[model samples]
Target: MTGSPVTTENVDPLAGVRAPGDPACDVYLTGTVFLDIIFTGLDSAPVRGTESWARGMGSSPGGVANMATALARLGLRTSLAAAFGDDKYGEYCWETLERGEGIDLSLSRTVPGWHSPVTVSMAYEGERTMVSHGHEAPVSEALPGPPPARSCVASLRAGAPQEWIAAAARAGSRVFADTGWDDTGAWDLAALPDLAHCEAFLPNAAEAMRYTRTDNPRAAARALTEIVPLAVVTMGAEGAYAADGRTGETAEVPAILVEALDTTGAGDVFVAGFVTGTLAGWPLGDRLALAGLTAALSVQEFGGSLSAPGWDEVAAWWRRVRDLTPADGRLAASLDRYGFLSGLLPEPAHPWPRRRAVPTLGFRALP
Candidate 1:
């Protein structure tokens, strides 16, 4: 990734070439970062005449910014390319993106407004209902060019300039676009022909199925390949499925073992983990395992990015989970080898590393 605090003479993106011997290690993460200023106003689990509730405030991030934050925290070289207003909210998002050790914002653009792109997540019985207002619009700012030579995962602004996605594809960077789950309207998936340039197309079951115009999710996954090279359909508890090309084989990967909380950015978190693992040369099963575990860990917390586990922690957690499940022995050995190379493991444990959080039914964490 381009924004890691660590830089190498061989790894410069401007070189239009990846440093030698780091093929599995090259990546650049770019997208939006925003403020998720939360206000706790709703009851924990509204019941009959449950009018009494508490009030508090928490500030985290929302949208792609939060997802990028999670990726950076996991120690990838990340470049955030979204535009923000030159005001407080934009400033807030900018500072948050730069707050983490491995994130860089040189590619971030600023518009002429005080409002930033943000969402208000209202907690309701451990889940969130968002009331969002974007004071900063995407049209008012300029986005930097897509990275050259390095690999990338675009947040897939369905309505944004298709040129950006195309440029990324032309550059040798693989695309993994994320949608905000809003109706596409005029910005339908059909408009983004650049999706064919992406190595993997990830869409939630509802979104993918809708885009493909089919209720049978497996068929939808297959149909998506007619447009893109490959597709991964994320189904919440049923886990996720993958297929490639027009007639590629599909496989089912089971969900990781974990108690659920709020599955806010579970999809985005899955992309980050899977893409990171793929760049590291992990096999299909391991990539799916990483995605599944990351998504599972994501729901056990309050907000989007903050809920994601760091890479080492996730790898450690994967190891612990691998022991309890009857997974392929090769995956266990491969994870172990990668761990040793990355200095990630000091022996291993059977249970995944667990993170616990208190749940509130109706309140947003302030950003």
Candidate 2:
């Protein structure tokens, strides 16, 4: 029997929408651009000085590529600003994201004689370890201009300069910021000023704890509220914590669990979903739930940027259980809660093409 028609009762009417003349793009992201070589299917970490083998290997643009592609897959008109080397690797990355994923890279440049950054990631037991090379220098401060949109995504790490944030704010753009994993544990307090300029500060639970000098994720999120007007701390598997400085409200959402194959870009996908919900003016709880589901779906496949689900996948999910009985329990309950799914549009005609040799993992080396 076929599933029943989906219902829209209790769904937020404004779950996803772009305001008229809001921005040139839905989300503008700026950060490092790297060619990612990902290897998977390892049962354990490599032994000291020993050779190890991997079952799967795929190459794709890493770093901000993950966020840019995810945003586009979610039907957001996305843009990226970064420096790329005038090398074959860079060309591959540019074409994959720009042509294959429909991302605007007009603000990104290709530097002559510079080799693009490359990262080799090894995935094992739901965790990943990456070794990278060729990051010679940061994208020059002059390279990235003011965000050309009303909403932008930024990284708080050293690589992402703060000048763009300042310029974007002056232009009345909303900035959403996230940070990188700190290997040194210094947890630089200086980054706080840059974060202050963001409309929302989203950091993982560990990063938030260290940055706020608190052990509890909720407490850390609360402390961040004192800085940015909105704060969200993502806790892998457990869920997410959020604090709204404007309404003096707080919320926690449970993670959506699924069989995870590779969690490479789950966080970035989560950010895309959260941004989608936020732009739609969904309630904080709805935003978190949507983000959690997006991340959950990403881990079900291989590759990083390529694994991101599009509107088609989301629509299929809704259709699968549209007619299921409430007695169907958790899945049914979640689908009902996300009744806003009814508003989702199908994948556009001539929506970016996918490379066949590797299927959905859009990786094409420059010939």
Which candidate wins on TM-score?
2
Cα RMSDs, all models: 7.0, 5.6
lDDT of 1: 0.63
Q: How far off is residue 298 in model 2, in Å? A: 0.8
TM-scores for all predictions: 0.75, 0.85
Per-residue lDDT of candidate 1, residues 100-206 (tens digit)? 33566677777764466667666666566777776545564667676553467765656555667677777677777755564545536766666767888888788
* Candidate 2 per-residue C-alpha lDDT over 1-367 given as tens digits, one digit per residue, 9 for 90 to 100: 9965433211222334645666667778887788888788888988899999988777888888999988887767788988887888898889889988889998888887788998888889988898889856543534757556758888777434577787887778788988888766678656456776789988999899998899899999999888899999999879998999899988888887787877888989988888888888888888888888778878877677867877656655666556578897677777656776666544233222222114223435589
- Superposed by TM-score, candidate 1 places the C-alpha of residue 77 at a distance from the truth, in angstroms, of 1.1
Worst 10-residue lDDT window for candidate 2 reads 348-357
- How well does candidate 1 score on lDDT at residue 44? 67
How many Å off is the CA of 347 in candidate 2?
9.5
**Which residue runs of candidate 2 sit more than 4 Å off their true CA positions?**
1-20, 137-142, 158-161, 188-190, 323-329, 345-367
